[model samples]
Target: MTFRHAADPVAVTADNWIHTSVLVLNASYEALDEIAADRAVVLIIGGAAEAIADRESYFAIRSTRVEVPLPQTIRLRRYVYIEHVPHGGDQSRATLAGVLRRDRHRCGYCAGWARTVDHIRPRSRGGPNTWDNLVACCVACNTAKADHTPEEVGMRLLWQPKAPTHRAKQQRKIWRQLAAGHA
Candidate 1:
């Protein structure tokens, strides 16, 4: 769409359109990643990809020699391999930092800001440092439950401990594919 003053008709409706997310698919139609709309357009214009779906309400972006309807999804012309990164899970080793991050620094017992992680079953009792056994804890709560399970301390956890849910974005393989001209 053409850029104009906000009050002008047919103006660029969204100043942040370039930052809009566009899903990218592998040539085999497997899902790959979400990329910026601008990048998707470049891929379309450069003949590296094809639009699979257009944006809702029919918005379009124009450059000096090309005008492409903004895309909601695009597919690469060539199939590329994606490597899956091992993700954190309930049984995975839970590091102090990872636990705090997963819990968003909120104590599992009191829902207060947490600076540490506590073992649901005290380490001395053979608690493994796994996601299922750890919770973010404030200094006070940690001290109060020291060397004891929540049941023994008569404290109840506000939330269950678990691994954070995050999609595994592909990495490293893109470079290799590009080097081999398969991207």
Candidate 2:
């Protein structure tokens, strides 16, 4: 989306499309980092990283290619191990709500207004309740989808649920602060 900048006479690419950020997590359910929405789109389409967002958009990056948010979290084809960045508690694996907040409440099922989280494999089945195993779930959907897999419940997920990539949660924090503007 384009917007006219008050600071400049020329229209500028309002970071709106890129407003949403993607978090990349390690296979171990660790907070690795974050990526811009555009870059995340690239990774999702090029088959590098699978989208963990419940809802993804078909963003026209540079008006050339389109990206798809994988319904499941994807691992890199090859192991290019990076530094393992630690998040909160070593034993405290992030909850689905925490993951959703980290993901800015974007649905891991549809990228819609998500206030709840869904365990991909269902906690009742020993799903371990980890970040990679969970995604954001909206209230009505989550209620209707209690203890059932997407397939079993007849709901399709938009993207895959994987650990976040490590970039700069700081960047997201910065955005939040900027948006809040010292309120």
Model 2 / residue 172 / CA error / Å: 4.8
TM-score of 1: 0.54
Q: List model 2 lDDT by residue over 154-173, tens digit each.
A: 88888776655444344444
lDDT (Cα, 0-100) at 111 in candidate 2: 71
TM-scores, each model vs. reference: 0.54, 0.45
RMSD of each: 8.3, 15.4
Cα displacement (angstroms), candidate 2, residue 89, comes to 15
**Clash pairs (backbone) in predicted model 1:** 1-60
In the range 1-183, model 1's lDDT, one tens digit per residue, is 332222334433457677577788999999887766777788788788899888656887898998899887899888887645566433346789878878889999999999989999999999988888999999999999999999999999998877654342243355347447733
